[model samples]
Target: MENNLLNLRMTSKMLSRQAKRCQKEENKELEKLKKAISAGGTEEARIYASNAIRKKSERLNITKMASRVDAVASRVQTALTMQQVVRSMGITVVSMEKAAQSMNLEQISAVMDKFEQQFEDLDVQTGYMEGAIGGTTALDMPQDEVDMLIQRTADQDGLELNAELANIQAPQYLPDEAS
Candidate 1:
């Protein structure tokens, strides 16, 4: 996994460099096209302009492809980070269970209950984490209720909702009397 991530980072860097090179080439072609268009009335100029446009289009395509490669790298990085977090959570649960083994039955029951409650809290937190990572959340409250809740919170903080800012006019500059 670490090797894969390293390769991905390298690939991303290479793609970014290629994209920059393509952009520079595109700019050169655009400048040539502008020159050709300005120095008009020749068949050679027309041909050069057409070729420049095609080359610029190809360069833009390459830049877009590089951007896609970077995006893929970013997603892979996020997945790897989440995997680490999950592995740590699993280890924590195992350690907690092992510790409970040294306790009396009543103590074990109490520890188990505590672990259960902690797991429930973890589950809630996991849901929120997933929601944040996935870019969408499951809203238990209705839209109107959520709006009202937000309004109440805002009111508690002395905030005005949907209030427009006052429009202040800029001071007019006056010319010097001597001028």
Candidate 2:
């Protein structure tokens, strides 16, 4: 459980780092587009600048991607908190299970088995998410590839879970001026 908490913290830090980098890139692109628009006064230059502006706008519309990432980060943070709570609950379960040793064997076994199954599911979810984001593994690939890999893994495990399943909830956007 301590290890899981540590990994969750590390994953959160990584996601924060990635989001910052994306924001920086987006800002740089926006600045370049603004400069081109302002300086390209000639007709020919204006045409080129118009193309650049269009491309930049397309990129900017990719704020959807950023928003998705932010939503996923928020969900991951929430999941980490829940995992910690579950770990604490697990301790209680362990104690109770120990005490229940004197009870009927079949009943205790069933309860313990259920808890074990839930823990396994939690662990698999963590592992799958970690791998998808290059968190714990060394798979330095593209986002599509990562998504495909995660999807394949999920399918293999009969999980049928959406690896790219990010909530579209509004995040508390940090303003550029604040920093």
Q: Who wins the lDDT comparison?
A: 1
TM-score of each: 0.52, 0.37
Worst 10 residues of 2 by lDDT: 167-176
- Alpha carbon deviation, residue 91, candidate 1 (Å): 1.4
RMSD of each: 14.3, 15.4
Tens-digit lDDT track for model 1 on 1-179? 76776776687678667767766766776677677777784675676667667766776666566556555555565676667667766766776676676656766676667667666766676675555434322233355545555555565698766643212222243223235
Candidate 2: tens digits of C-alpha lDDT, residues 1-179? 44554565566566556656655665665666566667764564565556656655655444434444544554565476567759856875985677597687776777777777777777776666665555432334565555556555565687756434432222243233265
In candidate 2, list every pair of residues with a backbone clash.
none
**Candidate 1, after superposition: displacement of residue 49 in Å?**
2.1
Q: For candidate 2, what is the total of clashing residue pairs?
A: 0
Best of the candidates, TM-score: 1
Q: Which pairs of residues have clashing backbones in candidate 1?
A: none
